[model samples]
Target: MLKKFAKQTLVAVSLAVSIPVFAASYTIGTGSQSGTYYPLGGILAKIWSENIDDFDMRAEVTAASVENTIKVATGKQLVGIAQGNVVLQANEGVKPFPRKMDVSVLFALYPNAVQFMVPADSDIHSISDLKGKRISLGAPGSGTRVSSVNILSTLGINESDVKPQSLNYTATTNALANGQIDAGVIVGSLGVGAITELALTRNIRILSFSEDDMQKIIAANPSYQPLEAPAETYKNVPAFTTPAVWNVLVVNKNMPQEQAYEMTKVAFDNMKKIRQVVGVTKFTTLENMNKLSGIALHPGAQQYLDEQMKK
Candidate 1:
C-alpha cells in the first residue's frame, strides 16, 4: 500500500512537470515595412518583451489602423496602432468600421499630422484645389486611405475626381518626386524621415486646412482636433503651418487584464525612453497620451493611470 501511494504521487509530480505552462505573448499590428510606425512598433515590442516578464510581445507589419482595428476586433491581433479619430469611428461603426469594433484604447501615442505633398511649382494649393489631379491615397485598408477618404469626402471630392493611386508612403514619395503623381497624402508627425527626405530633395508644399475645411471635418466628427505643424520641420523648408491629427495604441478586448495592466505600466514607465525611438517624438508624454486616445481606456491602462494619480 505504501509503495502504491508513492508511485501515484510520483506520477502526479511527473505529469505536472511535463505539462507545458502557457506563456502569454502579444503582437502589436503596426504599418508597412518601410514606414515609421513599423520601426516604432518594433521598439515597443522590444521594450515589452525584454523588460516585462509578465508577457511576451512583438510588432507586426500590417495594413495600419483601419485593418489593425479590425484585426484586434476579430482576435487576429492582440494590439494595434490606430489613428485617434479613426478609432472613435471604428467603435461607432463609422467609415472603415462597417460594424462596431471591439477594441479599447491603451493610450494615445503621437500626433499624426495630415501632410499633403506636391511639386514645388504645382498648381495644387489647397485641399479642394487638387481636383482633377493625380493623388496617392495610400494602400487599401490602411489608416491613410481611410483618413484621406474622410478628408476628401468632407471637401466634396471623391475617388473619381482624382486619379487615386493606392500606395504606401515610400511609394507615394517616389511617385511624387518622379512626377508620376501630382500629390501624396501622409499622416504622421512632422520630421518623419520619409517626408524629410522627400522635402530635402524636392520642392514640396504641405497644404493647410482652410477654416471651412476645419469646420466641416470637426462638425462631421467631434473627436477631430485642430492641430498645427510648425515650419522648417524638415530641411530646406521654411517654417510651415498646417492642421493635423494623431494616433492611438489599442488592445483587444479579450486580452488578459493582468498582461495588459503590466504592459501599460511598462509603457508609461519607459515612455521617456520610447521617445528616442524613431518616429516617436510626439508620443512621449502622458498629456499627449490623454489628448489623442479616443476609445475608452482599457482597465489595465486605467489602472496604471490610477496609480500615477496616486503618486
Candidate 2:
C-alpha cells in the first residue's frame, strides 16, 4: 500500500510539471470605465489572450491619453491607448510631459471628436463666449484637456480669461447638469455615453467651430483635423463641425518586435469580434492605418503593414 501511494504521488507531480504555463503576461492601460478606451482594451485583451499562444493580458483603467503615454513610456505598463496628438507631444517633450518618451504606435484606432457641450438655455453661443465662463476642460492628463487648450489658444483665449475646471466626462456632465459649470468639453467618439445621458435629462447645445476657427486650430496644431457630428447624434441636436484627433494604440519601444507583430496580426484577425463590443468599426480598418501620422510606428507594426502592402 505504501508503494502504491508513492507511485500515485509521483504521477501527480509529473502531470503538474507537464502542464504548460503562460509564457508572458502584459497589462494594457486604458481610459475611464465610461469611455471607449476601457471597453476597447477589454476586447483587445480578450483577442490577444485567446490567440497568442501561452500569453496573458489585462486591461487597466487609467486617466486616459496623457497618463497612458507616461505609463507606457516609463515601462510601468506594456501597452496603452492614447490620442495621436498626445503621443506626438510626449515624443517631443511637450508640456504635461517632463521629457521625451520613447514609444511607438501599434495602429490608429479611432477619431476622438472634441465636443463642447452646454445647457440649451445657456447664453454661451460660441467658443469666444466661453471666455469668463466656468468651463470644465476635462481631467488633468487627459487628451481632452490638451485639445481644449489648443482650441482656446487658437481662438486667442487664454486660460486666465476663463474659469477652468478639471473634471472627467462623468463628472463634467454631472457638474454641467447641476449648473456648477457653464460649459464643458468632452473628447470621445460620437454618441459618448456620458454626453448621451446628459442629453436625455437636459437639453444640451453642441457648440460649433466656424471655418476660420477650424483652420486656425489646425494651423496651430496640425494634429487636429476637422470633423462633423452628424445630425441626431445627440437627442434634438443638429449636425456641427469640430476639431478631431485620431486615437492610437501604443507600446513601449522595448517590446519585442516579433511580439508586436503577433499582436497586430491578432488585432486585425479579431477586428470583427472587437466591433461587436464597440460600434466604432468604421474607423478601425487597414486603410485608416495611414491616418496615424506624427507618431512613429513600432518595428513589428511596420513589418505587419509592409506585409499587408505586399499582399
Candidate 3:
C-alpha cells in the first residue's frame, strides 16, 4: 500500500503542466456520512485526483444509490456509487425514474448486505412481528430503503401496517440505541462502522428471512443473492441469513471514452486503497468487473476491462 501511494505521489509531483490553474471539476455522488459509500467515495476521489491531472475531483455526501443514479444520468454528477438493482431499474425505465436513464458502468463496487437488525431482547422476532413497531427503513432515495421495502412487500407487509422511519445509517443506529425505534434495516458492507459501534453498546440481533421466503424473493429478483451475516461481524451478534446486492460504479453515458478508460484503469491499478475501504471492497477488482446486468458499460471502461481479461 505504501509503495503504491509513493508511486502515485511521485507521478503527481513529476507531471509538467501549462494548463489553467482552475482546469475543470467533477463530483462523485456518495451516501450519508455514516455509511460506507461516503468513505469509499473519498478513496475513489483521491485516486482520481492524484492520477488524473487538471481536474478538481471530489466526493460529496448525498442520498445514496437511487439519488446517485439520477444525478449521474442527468449529468448533475460525473460519477457515482449505486446499487446494481437500482441502476437496472433506471436502465429499464422503471417507476421512480420517469424515463430510461442514460448511464454507463465503470466496474462493480461491493456487495451491500440487507442488515435487518433489532435489539436482542426485543419481541420482534420476525418480519411479521414488525407490523406495529417503529422501524427505520433507511433514508429517502436510498438503496437501503429499496431493499427494506422489497423485503416488507415480499413478506406481505405494507408501509401503513408499521410506523416507518426514513433515517440514514447513523440516525438509524442512534435511534435504535436510544430506544426510539424497535428495528432498522441498513444495506451496507459487513463490518459497517455504524453497526459496529452500536454493537459495542447494545447487543443486537441480525434478523433473517424465513428459508422458504428467501428462495421466493431470490427467484423474483435475480440481482439480489442469498447472503449470510456471520456471528463475527459484531459483538455477540448471531449468524443470520439475508439478501445482498452488488453496488456498481457508474458515470453519465456522455463521458468521453478515453476519460472513462483512464478512470477505470486508475481504479484497478490502485485497488489496494479501495480494498482497504471495507472488507467487501476486496471484490472490486478486474475479475468482478462485469457482474451487474442490464446497465451498459462505458465504452472506455469496457475496453480496459476486456484488455485485462486477455492477459
Whole-model lDDT per candidate: 0.79, 0.89, 0.88
Error of 2 at 56 (Å): 1.6
Task: Give the per-residue lDDT digits (tens) of candidate 2, residues 1-311.
Answer: 99999999999999999997756888899888888889999989989999999888889988899989999999988899999999998988988788888888999989999999989998988899999999999999899999898789889999999999999988999999999999999999988788888888999989999999999998888988999888889998778999999999988888899988999989998898999998885688888875767777899988998899899
Q: Assess candidate 2 and give its lDDT.
A: 0.89
How would the candidate models be sorted by TM-score, starting from the highest? 2, 3, 1
Predicted candidate 3 versus true structure: per-residue lDDT over 83-160, tens digit per residue? 998888888888668999998788998888898889999998888899989999999999999889987888889899
State residue 304's C-alpha deviation in candidate 3, in Å: 0.6
Error of 2 at 250 (Å): 1.1
Superpose all Cα atoms of candidate 2 onto the true structure and report the RMSD in Å to 1 decimal.
Answer: 3.2
Writing each residue's lDDT as its tens digit, candidate 1 over 1-311 gives 99999999999999999998765777889997667778888888888887876557789888788888888889988888878777788788876678888878887777777777888788987888889999999888787888888889877999899889998888999999999999998877667777888887898887778778888887876666677666677755555445466677877766677867888888777767677776455555665556654466888777777778787
TM-score attained by model 1: 0.89
Model 1, position 174: C-alpha lDDT score: 94
Misplaced by over 4 Å in model 1 are: 1-22
Q: List the residue pairs that clash in candidate 1.
A: 231-239, 231-240, 232-239
The residue-level lDDT of candidate 2 at 291 comes to: 77
Quality of model 3 by C-alpha lDDT: 0.88
Q: What TM-score, to 2 decimals, does candidate 2 have?
A: 0.93
